[model samples]
Target: MTMDWCPGIREACAHWQNATMLQHTFDALQMALESDSDASIDAVKGLVECICRVIIDQLDDPTSPLKPKDEASITEWVSAAIRVLGRGDVRDRKFADLIKHHNGLAESLRVLRNDAGPFSHGKDGFIQALTIYHRRAAILAADALVTFLYKAYLDSQLDPISSREPWERFAEGNALIDAHVGLVVDDDDSTTLRFILPSGDELPINIEVSRLLYQLDREAYVEALNAARGAQKPAQVREQGEH
Candidate 1:
């Protein structure tokens, strides 16, 4: 059975960059930020439009377990993909929440794309402001879906290989234990553990490792996804300043 799938989802959101991330609209945002380059704004606009147009494209990405299919509505594609990747595995409803929450994010992305498209070519300062806001909004929405894909990838790996197809990349996980003991607990009572491999993958504790770990180790595994890890971790700031 899946051992606390909610932790994986939390890890995916907290440490999203550790996964194979999508730069979706950031490449365009970078161009918009450049003041001197004549090609920057146009490039940004082009990239933003591409993201807008591809909302319903195939979810057959390397990070996705979905097989190639006819282009589907983004919600339809995600629903199918999640169902295949252990829709009933979680007892806590965390995975179900993510599936439901994604539609809102997709709508946000579409709105940003439509609202920002025209301003991308405008020279007026206020237009640039709207363009920047909308484009960034697009990125924020797209980022949620990107993180969910990573979470889904993790979930797919947890399922029995015989039930999954070969093209889904359902194979053995390669996480090697680099440290036998690691722990970090936050104020919210969530724990983080370092199950790093030599290849730099800080994976959550899968079932196999759970068998080998001591009770304390297993508890550490339970908390591993509560917060970010390493330099990607956010710094805590006080009321008026950073700590």
Candidate 2:
């Protein structure tokens, strides 16, 4: 039931002074979840709207043709954010298609919010109330969209040098190293060294503990090991003397 992306989203919003608003919205959502009310649906929609507006306002590129108007819909804001983060790269068909799909999803969420959200519109007739399952679905969708857009925004802020991995930067600095190498750290803490190919593919090799050790400064590594042993010797001697 936890929003795993809340911390990162709060961190991102901190710069814009939207942390208080985000917290209030989250608190309202939590209350709705506990009450099992349709207000959870409204909160989900409001959360997305809030994040989309933040992104549209802060990350909009003036030169980009995809920029949204001053009074744009939630879907338009989402699309504008995506376009700005993606650099309006229409050349990448895969990226274009993905953006299209995401924009559609945003639009669908907007429609759902209007139709199912109790507080969105006043109606004389009785409306069908959304169950916990619907709330969960909406929450998951909003989480995915907001997380993806925010991550893209953060990545777009990185410079070329900062975007490259450390070893890639080292390789770029070294004239003798003809190949560009990158490192990927897995969730389980295992490391893989990848040779980045010209076609953008990678040849990955799992780095063992011994190999990783040798990758560091050999002299410093040995000195640290000796220092550890030297320190342990005093403890061992003290134990024997005490015995």
Candidate 3:
């Protein structure tokens, strides 16, 4: 079955291994995420390449500005893509910080040029962590670009970023949700398992595994959390009254 909505795109994973997968297309990449590994890097690279094509499709004229032969122009276009997402006005507040982050993300993409090193093979802890950082940046960057460029296409469908957060935490929170919920297959039911998204959409979920997603749906978890907090308030009041 074709998955309608996959929360795996913005998954929040503390460790790298939990966020990597060999996805079919960047369009399809939202369905699965783990971390950046040597094995998974090629897939993500392809995914980003697909997103680049989408960017072209999104543009009004879709020519010049980003020349394949020019790294400088490519970086400029990437900078512009990072801006005006309702994140910042570029001339207004957050300008300085935005440039800093924009530069950082662009610099991180530089590592994609090379596939050999401790970062690529995972020998050094620090470099490996840096590579993971860069890869995730690429993922989020591509995802955000898609969100901005293809707003009409994305809005009509159930896509990545199911839940929303504050603007400042948007990127981090979006990435975090990817790992929060996952599909858990039922061994007894080899034929099917009912997995419904909060939006009431359903899908096959896997190749052989008929599954009920194991993790808590975001809405349910939030409701349960609020209830637990509310439950505590009454207990605290009762103790205060007794005192």
Candidate 4:
């Protein structure tokens, strides 16, 4: 059943942009960047920090799904930035470099998620534990994106006269399909270990990967939880009817 569950995490991540809390942060970041009266690059850094903080906060919630809509939130901000900063302002070489770095980070996150195994069978408890592991992995990727974006903004501030049109187009195209498809051999190995074992005389061969098992256990949990909740709901309805 765990194998059957499609990871809806991507969708959940996309939803934050529409959420009030995250939308306000994006608005503030946009306003700060648009008011470009100062040469200080701190505004750019502030934007990166705000984005990273929102994502980290969302990920901290164990029940949250990773939704593509959550990603759309960031993309929406990027689109708005293009309008405010102007296409040329974002297309500079420095901005290109920054986009490259953030793209790599986004790829890394995909790799880690792919390797983490599915949560179809895994219940909320198992997912909660896995969430702990994922946050550690996500932090590195998030940091790289934030730092690169800040630096790019700083570079733009220094060379406001530079041409950014080419790079802006390039970054927009890159962001769309920029994905990490790393070969997760370790995950494959874990699968083999889970389903296969070596046998020898006078020796016990047991393949154990606790994390994988924990994830599998979640499927068992979700099913039971759903069943229990379903049972309780009917009883509640009956009591209400009697009253």
Which candidate's TM-score is highest? 2
lDDT of 4 by residue, 1-243 (tens): 110111222122233445554355444434433542111122222333354444333222336433234445443443333222233245689876765555555655544443442332232322333443354345435445544433333333222133222334345434543442212224445533221212322322244544444456877667766777899999999999999
What's the true lDDT of residue 47 in model 3?
Answer: 40
Instruction: Report the poorest 10 consecutive residues by lDDT, candidate 4.
Output: 1-10
* Minimal lDDT window, size 10, model 1: 1-10
- Candidate 1: which stretches are off by over 4 Å? 1-71, 87-91, 118-131, 158-243
**Tens digit of per-residue lDDT, candidate 3, span 1-243:** 112222232221111122233124532343334323433333444443433333333332334433233333334444443332223344665765755665555445435524323433455434444355554555555444333434422322221243222233345544554445334456876655445544555544443321222142556666766887999999999999999
Residues 1-243, candidate 1, lDDT per residue (tens digit)? 111212322343343332222243443344444442323333333332333223223233446544325454444555555545555356678766766777666655544444444454353433434444444444445545555555555544443333222332333332222243333333442343445445655655333334444443666655553433432344433333552
Predict model 3's lDDT versus the native. Answer: 0.41
Best first by lDDT, ranked = 2, 1, 3, 4
TM-score for all models, in order of appearance: 0.36, 0.54, 0.33, 0.25
lDDT (C-alpha, whole model) for all candidates:
0.42, 0.66, 0.41, 0.40
lDDT of 2 by residue, 87-132 (tens): 4576788877777777777787777777777676765214486666
Provide the lDDT at 127 for model 1.
Answer: 42
